[model samples]
Target: MKKLFVLFCLTSILISCKKEKTTENNDDTGTSRAHSEWNDFGLKGNVKSTLEYTTEEKKDGGNTSSVRKFENQFSPDIALKFDNKGKLINKISYKENGNVAEDIVYDGKDKMISKRNFTTATEYVETKYTWEGDKNTIIARRFNGSRLLDKEVFQYNNGRLVEHYKYDGNEKQANRTSFSYDDNNRVSEESYFRNKPTMQTRLSIEYDDNGNKTSEIYYDKNFKVISKTNSVYNSYNQMLTSQTFTDNGSLDVELSRTYDDKKRLITKESFEVYDNSKNKEEFEYDQNDNTTVWKVYKNGKLVSETVYKYDFKNNLIYQIVTDGKGNEIYNKQIEYTYDDNNNWIGKKTTVNNIVFYTSRKIEYY
Candidate 1:
């Protein structure tokens, strides 16, 4: 469900300029410059734009090498195009059967301005944005065929998002979120609401000197304690233990983690108030920091295990899971193709013999 929601915003794929810096400049042309942003996405840089198309096919169990299409699926056959700055510009969505569904356009600032739905054969929605100075903060008004649906007013402080207020069609405050940041520029507290000035939930967090989260507290609308979690870390700043307590001060859940000499997580054990079952998981990583194997245990006995394999480019290529007795439970294989810049341009995955493919067309400035 969370992944589906993120699809609408492409939130996870957005690059943070503050955390990235150019790493290399190829010759004097400036066209083949390499940067940390490329490494972040498993590419070799020089990428200017990208257009991704994704689709899937299910195998016909009755016949081998045969497949059929359906109307409803996990993701529509949508093409997402991003500019040189990695900002999404145009999104063309197609129905499961390959017919145009919608076409969305974004402005130079990467703000959605219009969306037309082919099925409806009309403009579904249009948005107008009013910026606040030079910051990314803006007030966005959404319209459904000239009828105002809602407006979102965003506030930022020192380049950090501080608050957002949403108003419904009637121009009444519908919901809002407020954030407070610590000295380290990390969010220290967050509050949510369904109505203006009325908080539904609030979360307060504390961190150690090493920037590791030390504690978190959840509060109800009335600021009553809902739950509290405390974390203990080793000298290496790795979490050694975590305990969560209920509002009544009862230990609700506890987790103990063990790490290898290289500071890699090796095992994790969990305990809960109701079940107290000995649930544990062990992990082994490859040289590339990828988890190569994972073992699950119950009552000190191994229940299942999973093995992962990656290609030379550090792409996960295969995964296999088996029961305690070594009976195969699940398996998947993936293949990929890369461009001259070492950027992945195509991907194919087979799960239980059902294939899915995703292809990308990239352009450079």
Candidate 2:
């Protein structure tokens, strides 16, 4: 049920971005770069398709004895295909038994149009999307086979998402949410109505001169304050601290952060007022700005620490974790084989004496 709710929220949030003018040539390739999920994958080059899989080393006497155990043991776990413009078109995930577990399809514009999750050879759960003007997803519907389960509808005003409605399988409205923006075009208030005229809860937001969110106050239907959160920022507009208070004005939780001269976060701390408990995390970076060490503390005592090592190409090669007493608990080492494009095609990872090999097959345009 939680997974389904998350999928429902993702379908609605997909169209929340404000519409922007798309150009004919946005990249150096001179092709109109339509929306693509490839950017999120951190993949480089003009990729046409990718097949990824992993194999675990065969253990003997509770320990890996040789790398030869991994040979000829590969099984395709995921396969993805992209269009000429590098837009994802289709993706398939394989189950452990080598059966297709999920299949997803995207339109030429890179918008996900359909996703089907197979529960058996014949039964499946499917979600379909409908788009309106400017690639706006207007409706999303989920179905268990031929029976509808739920549906979401989105409304936009001047390219800004202004309202969202959820409906059950019977097409009866379940809930509605509306948004109001301030003069800066930022969302100033959010109202949620649970199939009622009065909002069940409303959140009011305020921003500072730098356009940073400064406060958020939540109120009940009777206009009574429920909780409030406030944030403070430094001159660089970096968040310094945030505090949340209950309706009675008692501090509930507080979080603070410290940054280095380069404006990179170096330390973060959190405190719970009622429990009187605190936690902190500190980080150290190398000359290349890569994190070298990370430490976690509970109530000012070290709990865990991790050390990182990277290669000249800035690829993480090794990392080790230890407990408070400096006893090694976890260790990972990676070896990479890159293609001419400097993209890793194969990698081997060793974790606590256990080995796993991952390979990627990439095709360029």
Candidate 3:
């Protein structure tokens, strides 16, 4: 579910970026990259992102806000970097100190044929990539500690993703997902599989005269409406509002959107966590659609608040999770310093000021 959702978002992002290529790779070994799923799903491999820690001083001297304490993150790096020929190139990774971790070779278009994590010593993971053409047809990401976590596949037609299947080794017959498009070359339907069509949750959609989504619905095998969503759009094709209904006919989620004069997303108000027991929480965003801050309330009484800050790379730099007393409950500070080797490093994080712990990471091939 995690990989699938990520792939779905990447596909949309790729399409939005308009840098996507059209090519398909057909291979039986499940290591090809010619399918649209890679563009949609992005890459699948045992990847790693390093985390580091340190300390510093805060304005209020009561607690040690200046240092990072406890738990530095460490993982195997496994990301594919391809070339123009659609062949896999080098697999890149980095350490916490901004050092070379690993550099694995790829075929063309940067599809990783093999990955070696850090001296092959004390390693817990490895991955292999395969492709047919420009599309990533299949791949496997594995970790060898105790057991396997996930494995998945993508099916494509020409240069478009048609289906995706995932297996947890245990689940209801490998959760399968299929995609389809309309004559306008726009996605028309997406179906979730529970092995067979008889066990499917299908989502069907319709477009309006302006190419804006008009209605979206979910249905059970019996063709009964399980849930539905309705959207309204302005003449400029900007979404004005969207509301979703649950399978039980209750409001599941609601969103109100607003755009700037430039039609860019300026603000969005959302409601989630339908506990019915707890007051439905609300969220507001900034002009950039960035969540500057959010508050949770219980029956009009504020409970918690979270604030965010982003870096020049648009990455989350810091987050403060606090109580209404303005007293800090939990906090996170991050600094990512990258290198040119495609291997990353110098990424830091600080947590729990009371108990100070600092950690660092450095990766090697």
lDDT string, candidate 1, 1-365, tens digits: 34433331131112110122234655223544342233334444444556556666644676535232321344455555555644456778766555667777764424565665554544465556565555545444444457777888888877888998888888898889999999899989999987956789999999998988899999999899999999999999989999999999999999999999889999999988878777999989877666788888887888777777777766767777777889876666778898876667887866656676777787754
Q: Which rank order by TM-score, best down to worst?
A: 2, 1, 3
What is the TM-score (0 to 1) of candidate 1? 0.67
Instruction: List the candidates ranked by lDDT, beginning with the highest.
Output: 2, 1, 3
Instruction: State every prediction's TM-score relative to the real structure.
Output: 0.67, 0.81, 0.52
**Predicted structure with the largest lDDT when compared to the true one:** 2
Worst 10 residues of 3 by lDDT: 40-49
Q: What would the per-residue lDDT of candidate 3 be over residues 277-306, giving only the tens digit for each residue?
A: 333244444444455565655545666666
Candidate 2 structure quality by residue, lDDT tens digits, 185-298: 999999999998779999999999998989999999988999999999998999999999999999999999999999888999999998899999998988767777878898
Runs in model 2 with CA error above 4 Å?
1-40, 60-76, 107-110, 120-122, 133-135, 139-141
CA lDDT, every prediction?
Answer: 0.69, 0.75, 0.56
Output the TM-score of candidate 3: 0.52
* Per-model tally of clashing residue pairs: 0, 0, 50
- In terms of TM-score, the best-performing candidate is 2
Q: Which ranges of candidate 3 are over 4 A from the true structure? A: 1-125, 141-151, 166-175, 197-199, 208-213, 233-239, 247-249, 259-268, 272-274, 277-299, 306-321, 330-365
Which wins on lDDT, candidate 2 or candidate 3? 2
